[model samples]
Target: MDVVALIGRILFVVLFLGSGFAHLTQTEAMSGYAASKGVPAAKLATQITGVMMIIGAVMILLGVWSDLGALLLVVFLIPTAVLMHAFWKETDAQAKQMEMIQFQKDLALGGAALLLFALYAKLGDDLGLTITGPLFK
Candidate 1:
């Protein structure tokens, strides 16, 4: 692995893992935040999002089932950007600005996930994993 890709993966790991921790540790607060966006039982939303983020982050970091991993992140972040960080229209100028930035970040995260999907087939390709009879090798 070249230094740059390795660094990119590390950054990906840090982001997803850190977000998972936030969801896990601050469930109640996040749940309240969710409720503010019209989410029902925001507390439950926190737990679900936390668990999902952890699973996805672990898979990506381990380079196992990474295509699925990216898919999970992509799916999770859409609702997150739309519901949790909603910035569509807000009269409170300051609050709107913050929410807009948050939304943009989530959108960027989602885009990265899609990029992962596009790049999935080449992942660890240099490692040469193949299925064959022992004699075939």
Candidate 2:
């Protein structure tokens, strides 16, 4: 069960870890896309959020302060979905469909992060293989 939990955690954070690395390494290209989407200080925002995603992924993967890591993901996902995947603003049918898909994916991930946050906050002691446990309690 502990091993399973560890594997689950690893799988859950994989997207974040990879995407976070891209956010840092592909800063210029990512920031340009972000600017096209009207993100202010796009470069800085990309860098900061990259760090957030990487730190959050590491925390969750290591089972240290997993709740805080989840919160970081929530913080990153919500705004990104709203700002970057504004499907309603798209007029092209295919583009709108793609953006909507991205929006939904982001929301789904955000919801999962929220559940993780709650799990650690309410049941940290019961969780298997944790290091420092939830930072909240």
Please report how far candidate 2 places residue 120 from its true position, in Å: 0.8
Q: Candidate 1, TM-score vs. the true structure?
A: 0.82
Tens digits of per-residue lDDT for model 1 on 1-137?
A: 44555456557868878878898898888777778789887888788878888887776666666666777889888888988777667889898999999999999999998787567645433322212111111
State each model's C-alpha RMSD to the native. Answer: 5.2, 0.8
Which portions of model 2 miss their true places by more than 4 Å? Answer: none
lDDT of 2 by residue, 30-103 (tens): 99999999999999999999999999999989989999999999999999999999999999999999999999
Estimated TM-score for each candidate: 0.82, 0.97
| Residue pairs that clash (backbone atoms under 3 angstroms), model 2 | none
